[model samples]
Structure formats: structure tokens, C-alpha cells
Target: MTGLSGSGKSTAGRLLAQRLGRPLFDIDVLIEQHYGERIPTIFAHHGEEYFRDLESRILERTIQQTDSAIIVTGGGIVIRSENRQLMATHGVRIYMQVDPQISLERLRAQIASEEQQGKRPELRPMLAGPDPLANLLTMQATRESWYQEAEYLCVTNGRPVEHVVQEIIDMIEPTRNENEHAASLIGTPELSEPSTSDPVIPPIIRHVHIGDGYDTIVEWGGLSHIAEHLQRLSLPPRVFLITDSNIHDFYAPMLVARLRAAQFEPHVYTIPAGEASKSQRQLNAIYDWLVDQHAERREALIALGGGVVGDLVGFAAATYLRGVPLIQIPTSLLAQVDSAIGGKTGINHAKGKNLIGAFYHPRLVLADPLVLLSLQTRSRTEGWAEIVKYGIILDAELFALLEAHAEALREFSPASKALFCQIIARCIDLKVTIIEEDEREQGRRAILNYGHTAGHALENASGYGEWLHGEAVSLGMVVAARLAQKAGLYASEDVERQNNLLTALGLPTTYHGTVSAQDILSRMQLDKKVVGKRVHWIMPERIGQVRSMTLPDELVTQVVTEFFGAEEDHSHA
Candidate 1:
């Protein structure tokens, strides 16, 4: 059944397939393991535009080849008009709806429990810097409407797994009969009201084709995988390890050891920490470092550190020698969740963060949670903000896990170490599932940007250093929730609950006094989220759903006023 992300799309789809003895098809999972690298890495490498085109083409092909199977789509699949039309033509569409609160609680529980499982990696994209629940609330607002377009609606509120499965089974019986009749009546030009009462959903399917997912992971084995994948030429063996000072102390040695173990020669280069390192000066230094290392086109560049380092090194690798193979070894939580997985690499421009970057998909991404162990608490928590985002936008169970174990999560308590890994892995799995289906983000992948619209605006307006990315995002989520409330998508109580959770986590619901609403709005205009020069916001509806909307300029301003005035805190970010 299709619905919002945490509404149990994957679980229900699997259950129905099992009970009915039909093949279960999860487009996201199908592509998860195929890529050697992460989907976000590819986006960073190939650019969103290129990724979208690739995603659309792949989706078109996949749908055409599949038979009668149970399909679980990404939350934003309905946003692409073409995909929706295809679904209506090719298969039965059903929405498995759940209460937003339930969905949110489920997500938090999923992530928190996973951390206890030891199979989890790191909690990357599921939290807001210090606050996670607020981000979830914001995410719910951003994707609610897009999820309402399903053909069949099945409420999953307070229901057991078997009960939900049976309900879907019951719906399918009538839907199938309806489909058969519709086929026979397809050519009729005129129809009576009774005959037209139930319309047949289309089933035109599309398969998104992405290059081998395996090739995306260059750092995993130096050039071993690439050597086997594309065995055209063998050049002199050399390696460039590009990272920041902080990461150099953490992961560079591990990467260097791996390369050496693989019989490849490698060298390391280090930059300072934070956003400033991603500048022309740093890029030039990297070029010089490459020259000193005798790096060549055939050699691989290993990027180790957080997002800033990855962007800097990846861009250098993309432009150096016209293009060198780049691999990613992300150290920080943020890099692992958002930056490391996607191929969009670049440093911050004076005008905006990440304004100048290349879509240079990495050869591969090797994520080792061991590297994250070295992170300071603030840095660790910074990544949690993004982790909370994954649940808010789609996965309800993950949200629940965060809520259940917020205290342990905040401190990365020893008892919760395993939970951390599972949380990270789950988020990775969720993201990979979406990226595999819509690598270019022409359709399903945009759901991943659940809180980024306002988050980016805050970052740009306040200057890159003003607030941690996750911190701004935490506040952005609050503002988005307020906007959703104003739009009447959910009750004001939902917004208050969000603010309370954030306040408890030490994350602000409003911006610091230095940032003005107009400045943020102006910077928002420069956000890449703008379509046709119109800023599209991902607003919340309830606790577990969100949808996109293009707010009027005045409305946005009013919302901003409410956001800043929503609380009386005047602390710095």
C-alpha cells in the first residue's frame, strides 16, 4: 500500500505480497545494494539535474518490465505528474494512511532500537543538531499533501500488522474486479455516472537506470573495483588523501592503511576545519598537494572528513587533471548522512554555501562508524539533526526511536552505541532505497529535502559560520511547522509540541537576534529549491506528513514573523 513514508508502505507492501503469494517489489530496496557508492554521492557527482534525468529514465524502464506485483513507491512519487499517470495506467494504487503522531513515534522507536542492535552505524540524518523531534514535526508538514493522492486509502491508525494486511487484501479484491471491467470499457467514448463512479488507476511503469551502484565506492578498495568494472587501461599507481586536520587525525590513517594493504601508493593532504577550508585558496593548495603527490588522472583521490572536506576534495578531484577518480571516507555524521552520500562537491561561496560545486559522483563511499567515535558531542549531535529529518520526511518508526531514547542519543551513551549504528544503517537504507529509484530526484528523491528549504535560507542569511547546519535546520523545522499550522494543515498543538521538544534538546525554535527575517527571505530566494524562480516550501500537515507548496511572498513574510515571535528566546545559534 502507498501512503506517507512511515505509514508502513514497505511493510504493508511486503505483507500483502507474502499473504497473497505475489512478488513484492520495493523500488528503493531493489537498487540499494547495487550501487557501490551511496545515492547522495552520485547526486553530488552528477548534479541533481543529471540525476533527475537518470532517475526518470530508470523508473520508466523498470515499470514497463514488471508484471503484476506489489509495489512500494517513494513518498514523493506522486509529485512527478508523469509517474502518477504511469501508476494509474500500469497498476493498482492504494494509500496506507496512519495518524501522524503514530507514524512519528514509530520512526523514533525504530532508530533508537536499531542503535541498541549493534548492527546500526551512526545516527546521521535522523536528528536536528541538538533537537530531533522538532525536525520531525517540520518534516511532517513538508510531505503530507503529496501523500494524499493515492487511489485507495487504508487507515492504519492503531492497527496491528496482520489487521492492516487483511484490510489491504480486502481492498484489492474489489479493485481487481474494477480494473478488469475498466479494461473492457476502455474504448467507450461515453459513460454513465454509475459506471464512472469508480475510476481505474493506471499502471504504466517506469524503470530508473543508474550506472553500477558498486562503482560509486572507490575508497572501499582504492581502484580495485573500478579496475575490474572498467578494465580499459592501467596507469601508474598513485593516491591522494584529501582531508581536513581534524579528519586527518581520525580517518586518513585508516584509509591510507587500506590503500597500502591493497598494494597502492598513497599520500595525505590536510586542511583546517569548518566551511572556510572549502575556498579557492584551499582548492589551490589541494592542486599543489596533488602535484606534490604526483597524482594523475588514473590515480584516486580519497576524501576523509565531514561534508566540507568531502566537497573540497571531491571538487578538486573532479577538476584536477580534468577529472580524477574520487572516493569518500566521511568522518562526521553530517557527511555520512547528506554530504558524503551525494556527489555534489564544492566549497562555500562568499554569497552562499555550496553555491559553486560540481556534480562529481564519487567512485565509492566507505562509511566506518569507528571514524565517528572520535567526534565531539556537538559535532556528533549536529549530524543527529539530519537523522531526525529522515524520519520526519518518511520513516515514522525511526521518529519513535529517537523520542524513546532522546537522552541516551544526546550523549551517545555507551549502552546505546549499537543503537547508533543501526540508526545510521537504517537511514542509509532508507536513503539508498529512494536514491536508487530516483537518483536524479526527478520524482521520489525530493522527499529527502524535507527541511532543507528553510535550513538553507537560515544558513545563507546568517553566514555559513553563524550556526551549525543542523542547528539552523532545527529552527527551520520549527518555522516550517508554524507555517503549516497557519495554513491549517494541522492543529496548533502540534506546533507547540514541536517547540517543546526542541527547547528540551537545547535547540532554538527561532533564529538568533542578529538574523533578520528579510535577510533570510532574500537568501531563501537564492536557494536551489526554487522552481521557476519561485521558492517551493516543504510544509507540515500533521505529525508524520508533509507536502510542498509555493507560498505567496506576503504569506512567507507573515510566517517568518510568527516563527521569530513564536518564542521569546534570544540566544545565539
Candidate 2:
């Protein structure tokens, strides 16, 4: 099913999926679940390049893997040549048509209804501004020919969803020849049976979407089968695998060997590991390496490390000689759960972390939890800060789940794959929700920085190497909860619950670094989230809720001072 927004694709598709008793793979929902964000958020954060890339990837995967299912796609899915081709070759295609004006009206009604229910509905960014009807018409003009290419077209304006769905059902099963129709519905060509002499071919991949699209791919041994996956993608044969030294020793050689076995030209480059590697110097080195290898726009750069490598290589992919395709293979817990998804790429400055960057998303992200086994306890434990942030600011259930599994998770137990995967997927989902709301950190996205306002400052003041980003955030969340309490916005008991979770997760709940409150304050003023010379503080009203506001600098200082531990010698740090 395909159509402009408000054309009732979702409405009709739901009925069709039920009638057929098949799963519904609504592209919009799949994109949201896979990317862990919404269409508008993807647009606001990653831009058209990133969104289209994901859209195409998801469309292809949906078509390739499905035997029989209702696959509803966004109208703009036709914008790309690959998408048009993928749909053309597969499915009993149906285009749901509606008047642009009607579409616009339905959208407004949806927005109004969603708001009334306190739901965060997604809008097609292309057709969401003033003169939306004009935008819709313009989009229709661009996509009309493609929409017309579908095998069947059903007008949806003024018609009931059941009527439209039945009409589609009739088209799908013209003579009531149930067997033949079922065969077509399930995409069985049945042209001819190949003899045993025929060459063996790989079957369609089961692409498991975690968030945006690349979330669950790692659990399926996506790394072990990287070569096979690459063979199926449209990327160039020349691949660049970039990682930090700390990561290179663990997985780079194996990945390189596989790529070579598959006849791909893999150029491996290793940078010094740590946050410091996310710098202009390292970025320049990547550029030089790409040039030395005569990298072209068709070439893909694989970021095979944690957030530092993901951010640095992602930026290089975003701007090196214009742009190149990027594939994120995040090996760290933090990178997999937060950094790798949503395409927030950048480098840090001497003054602050991630002060320079772009919203260039990766073409694909492969997260293998098995790889996290390589992380030390400190590295593994810090990622919980971000995960816990999700529960604290948006999802109370996730927080409770973490509490239930706190001890096991802290131990990184290999026995809890299902639990771990669910936690990871849910965390990515919440992150996407925020990006959909405000990817630029102007409004809803600010909530994502619940602990980051002070966290980033503390990270900088203590020196980047002093504390892991997640540990700093864990402490920041604790302080913010306390701040809310002092400001009469929250109860002290809830603050303790939030704090106790972090402590149980093996995260830091207090600061004892050499950095002073004054130093932290000075750094806070320089945070990217600052608005009109005032830093925005995201304080919790309670678990699963947060509000953005500015607290008095004096009060902020007092809270930090209260939580401060005895000055510890950190020269080693």
C-alpha cells in the first residue's frame, strides 16, 4: 500500500493485514521502530539524504523478506529509483489515492486528535508547513507517475476504509481462484523449477529492525555475515573500515579477512582510541587516507568502533569530498544503544564535547551485542547511564526492568540475550521519539539531554578522559533529580529511587573529581544547549517524565556542592 499522508494507507492496510491474517509491515511504523524515531524527526535531524537512504533500505528489506504481508510505505518511498524498482518487482501493489486538499484536512484532523490524546504524531516534513495543500500537490506532481506505476489504484477520498480495503481485496483475488491468488499474494513466481545443476544462491536475509532500521541486525551475526550483506547492497566494492586502536585489536582483523574473502577491497585505518580521537586532527587524517585510497562518492566508510569512532568517521563520511556512504558497526554498548542511531555525527573541541558536527546518518548500522563482551567493566557499565535516562525521562517500565535485572545486567550476563535485546531496542525507540519531536535539541530533543547539560560540562571540566560520558550523565541525572526536589518540583523519595538505580547499575552517583563547582559552571555556559546565554536544564517531575527549564545558577551550584565528595587526587586520570 502506498499513498500521500492521510490517504488511508494505514487504515486500509490494517484491515487488509487482518483479512489476510498476515503481519502488517507499515513502512512508517517499521521506520519508526527500526530507526527508533519518526519521519519528521528523521527529517529534522538527519535531512533528506539520511531519511531517503533509510526509507529505501527499509523498503527493500520489507519486500525482500516478506512471503505474504501488508507492506504500507510512505508516499515519498517512490522518490528514489531503487524504491520504485523494488516495489515494481514485488507485491500485489496497490496505490491509495486521495485529493490533496482532503489529505491535508485529514492530516490536520489527525494532528488535532493526536494532540487531544497526548500522542506524539509524526507528520511528513515535506508537507507539514504553511500552504500544506500546495506542498502536497507539489509532492504529488513529483510522485504521481511513480504512484501510477502500482498495479492497482483505489481512490480513498470520502470512502469508508472497509469499502476501500474490500475493493483492494477484490483486485487481489479477481476470479476467486484462491490457490492462484494466494500464490501471487505470497510472491511465488513458480516460473520453473531449477535442476540440481543450477548454482546455489543465498536466500533473502531476515533483516531485524531495532531502531530506524539497523538495530537487530547485529544479533543475527551480522558481523560474521558482513560479506554476504555487503554483496547484496548497492555500495561500492572498495570499503573503508575505520576504527580506534582499542577496537582494531579486537575485531578489525576478522572483519577485514571476511571482506577480502568476499573479494571486497577493504582499507583498514586505526586511530588512537579514546574521546580525544574525536578531533580535527583525526578527522584530517581520515580525509588524507580517503584521498590516498582515491575514495569516491560510491565508496563506503565503516565505523567499527564506539561513539568516538562512529562520530569521527561519520563526519568524514558526511563531508569528505562532498559525501560518501557510511555504515555504522558500533561495537560499544553506548554506541549501539544511543550514538549510532539517529545519525548525530561530530567531533569535539578544546572547549567542549561535540561542539562541531553534522546530522549525517549512516546508510546502515550493525550492532552485535556479542562484541560488547570485549569491553571492560567501566566501559560496559557507563552505557547504563543513557539507558537509565530513557527510563527516567520517558519510560517507567524500562526503569523497572533495569531495576529487576540490575545485578545481572551489571555483570553483563550472556544468558540474557532476549532481555538485553529488548532493553536495547526500547532505548533506541525512546531516543527516536525525542528526535522526532525535536531532533535539533530546540524543544523535545532537549529532554534527551536530561543529564547532559551538567554532564557535558562536568565531562569537559574534569577533562574528557576523567569520566566516561555515561558515568558523568548518571551523576548528572542524580543531581538534576535533587535540583528538582530543592525547587519543589519533585519529591525527595523519588530522587532516591532514581539515584539508587544508577548506583545499582554500577554508575557514578556523585562527583569527587578535581574539578570544582565554579569550573563546572564556567563550562556549562559553553554547552551547545545554551539558549540566549542561559543553559537549559532538564529536570524530572517524576520517573518517566521531565520538563525543560532554567534553574538559578546559585541553586545549581548549591546542588553540585551538596553532592560533591571529598576532593580526590585525579592526576592519574
Which has the greatest lDDT? Answer: 2
CA RMSD (A), model 2: 22.6
Candidate 2 per-residue C-alpha lDDT over 355-377 given as tens digits, one digit per residue, 9 for 90 to 100: 99998767677777656655767
Judged by lDDT against the true structure, how good is candidate 1?
0.63
Question: Residue 178 in model 1: shift from native, Å?
Answer: 77
Which regions in candidate 1 have their CA more than 4 angstroms from the true location?
1-209, 215-237, 254-258, 496-506, 565-573
TM-score of 1: 0.58
lDDT of the structure predicted as candidate 2: 0.76
State TM-scores per candidate: 0.58, 0.62
Candidate lDDT values, in order: 0.63, 0.76
Model 1, 467-544: lDDT tens digits are 888787887887777777777785787677566655655566656656667677778878767889998777767656
